[model samples]
Target: MSGLGQSGVTAVKWSAVSTLARFVLQLVAQIILARTLGPEIFGIFAIGMVVLTFATFFSGFGFSWSLLQRPTLCDEDVRFAWTWQLVVGLITMLGVYLLAPALSAYFREPRAQSVIEWLSIACLLSAAAAPSTYLLQRDLNFRAGGLIQVGSYMAGYVTVGVPMAILGWGATSLVAAWLVQAAVALVASYVVKPHAVRPLFWYADAASAVGTGRAVFLTNIVNWMLNNLDRVMIGRLLNAQALGLYNVAYNLAAMPNNLLLGALQPAFLAAGARLQGELDRLGRAYFQMLATIFVLVFPVFVFLALESNDLVHLLYGSKWSDAGSVLCILFLIMPAYVIWGLSTPVLWNTGRKYYESVLQLPILAIGALGFYFFAHQGLQAAATVAALVLVLRAVVVGTTAFRALKLSWIELLPDVGRGMILSALCAISVKAGQAAVSDYEMPLLSLAASTLTALGVLTLLLVIRPQILGVQSATMVIRFFPGMAQLLSRANPSTQRGPITNPVSEQRL
Candidate 1:
């Protein structure tokens, strides 16, 4: 009802729509690419992309966060940020190009050299578009951002990548597709919200911008390591095929976080920044975000974990069966990763920016030891270690974030304490359905039965006992569909534990 609430609703809608569209497009494209190119090719491209992705942070150096957190920005700051991005992109691109051979060699795929080299171009393209893309986020305008992402994916991956894979171009197809995606995004972003690209020639031109981004850059660097170290280890310690399988599994297990939480991130971050000084409002918003993830994302993750092998074969074909075991292991980290991700904006916006980077120091050391120990065993073992590290980091970081905001898990669990119970029930329903047809070779039928059974059980519970997810979550859900608010309330008073109330009601959003 308030201005912040209204814009946030629109932003949330657009962000969710865009991410859902992109997620669907990616799912279809990956399925096709997996069948057409197979694991070996994807593994090779993964090696290159992993490197480029890590270096990508430097290309913009978290300047986007720098933009968002700032209350005021002069033209010089924007131009400098753009110029800095372009220069760093070029440098990182060149570095990746030169190291392509070594990178490919490390992955035991000498043929990946050219692929990595070509993929380096994406760095430049994305860097060039940072100012424009981030400017939209800064303004809380996610419509153009969503449109750019979907249109780019369609133009690049769905339209280009799939065809090339079908034609047997291998990694070249992937490289080309990614470049095209970046190109399309670059062009579209600038066209929608143009920013000056002229070089400022001196860092002093935007000292405040540089100062703000320092910790964010460091934090992103460590976050990238936490996210990708397993893939790096898999590639180095195992082989291309193993890396390929793990990548696919990782993608599947992390999809919920990638799609839903990721989509909500920009909107939530911008909204939090607007109320950076309002501790109560920000903490309430944070709780709502966790609730949203628990209610919407946990079910999907549970289904994935419970039905990993069948789900893999159903979607990515039988060739990807090995990734199922790895996916099952990786599922342990999904909810934890969300906590880690959501905490970043809280830290950065609330002037606890450097605290995150510092926290990563011990966690990174622990993670490195775990990965080094388990990586040599096998993919599943490595995945197990990755999951442990993520959970640990989430606990540490999430606790720290809570304390920083003057909130605590014990205080907040009432809103989502029963989520684990709901997830457990859903998992049981899924397993029961699978067990009924365990002997049959009908993945589709089994999946359908499992899904329907789970949905039926969840719906029944929510209808009879809406308090299962607490009033806060129910209120948040209803806020997304205001018309249902009164209907649900009037339908049955006993259904909910407490009266539904907006967490952001008349607050600073």
Candidate 2:
């Protein structure tokens, strides 16, 4: 047992499996829903999601997360958090129900009234499940948590949502799936870790949680604005159809980032918290994670950006052609968005929660103000503004996190530079591969060729000099594969290296 009763590798493995499974479910669901429903329907649901996601920010007032952050916790704190969040959940549900009409009008989507009202059910369900789920996370029990999560999603989307869409349930299919997923999660999370479900009376028992919860809650609210302001503005300023297109593009761009971060964040937090006093170890682990993620995922987004039009056409059919440009713009910023997300756990576990929260305020302001100005121009302009916000946010939060951690970005540059160089190389490979297959006049085959070409080039480069991606990060990954470490060692020439190129020190992890 490393920290929180599980090794980071094991926790990451389980979480990745769960995240990948859920992504497959979601991707399938999205394909079905997008094909069956009109853009207007998605536009309405997107607006509703905007409201639901906002309420979610303050639903438990971040108390569940406080469970993870607090230096000490008691059963009383768990009970209090559960009791508090349930109450807020009910209140939030009712509030959204009542405000649905007004919110729909503000967004200029009249049908969103019913959509928002129906989706409100998830608010209570999510809140009810928060504490139990957090407890699982705080313990780093990703195995049980992963199973419960993926199983719930499978039940909700596969059993309920997909079949209903096939039956032509329109936007209601989405709302039904949303509620079912939340309800399933609520029941399963509690069952897996049945904490004190007793109601609370004495608020004073939660003094320790309250302090951290307050900061996280406030930060999440600002963070929510940073994430959702573009959607809000796009819906309000543009027509529902336009909003629909942008929503599709935005979610598609965000999917991999969410999946990647969702899998690793818990492990990072638990591991970093345990290693907090060991700054050198913590710094090395953090850099390794960053480099590993960048090398693996950054090129993926680049490939998506380059192939956006064909990807949209293939996945969403020709009707969503307009979304391709939007996807291209949004995908370009994924690296920055992911970098920003990865910084969150580092900041929180290091007890710099307030500093991180403060970082979001101006970013939110800039995004909001920028969107207001640019949204009128078109969806393209709004996406550009959104992209700028992500890059700026990564710079801002990343700098602060580095300062707080007393780490030097200069040390990580060699690895990042190599990843960037590889990305450019893969970009050229994509063009060459696409050209090679274009003669066949098959879009699907062309895409496959491009993807294979890029990945193949990347794999060969890393094999030749895995240290260029940081031996630490590279080693962390291939440790999972038996004998693969020895294979890489044999492929690369032995060198007396300075940190970035040292195969010898890679054994430390």
Model 2: per-residue lDDT, tens digit, 209-261?
77877888888888888889988999998978988999988888888888888
User: In terms of TM-score, how similar is model 1 to the real structure?
Assistant: 0.95
lDDT winner: 1
lDDT of 2: 0.80
Candidate 1 lDDT at 432 equals: 88
lDDT of every model, 2 decimals? 0.80, 0.80
lDDT of 1 by residue, 48-106 (tens): 88988887888878665577777777777787788788888899899988988888887
- RMSD for all candidates, in order, please: 2.3, 3.0
- How big is the positional error of residue 498 in model 2, measured in Å on the Cα after superposition? 18
Q: What stretches of model 1 exceed 4 Å from their correct place?
A: 1-4, 203-205, 487-499, 507-509
Worst 10 residues of 2 by lDDT: 498-507
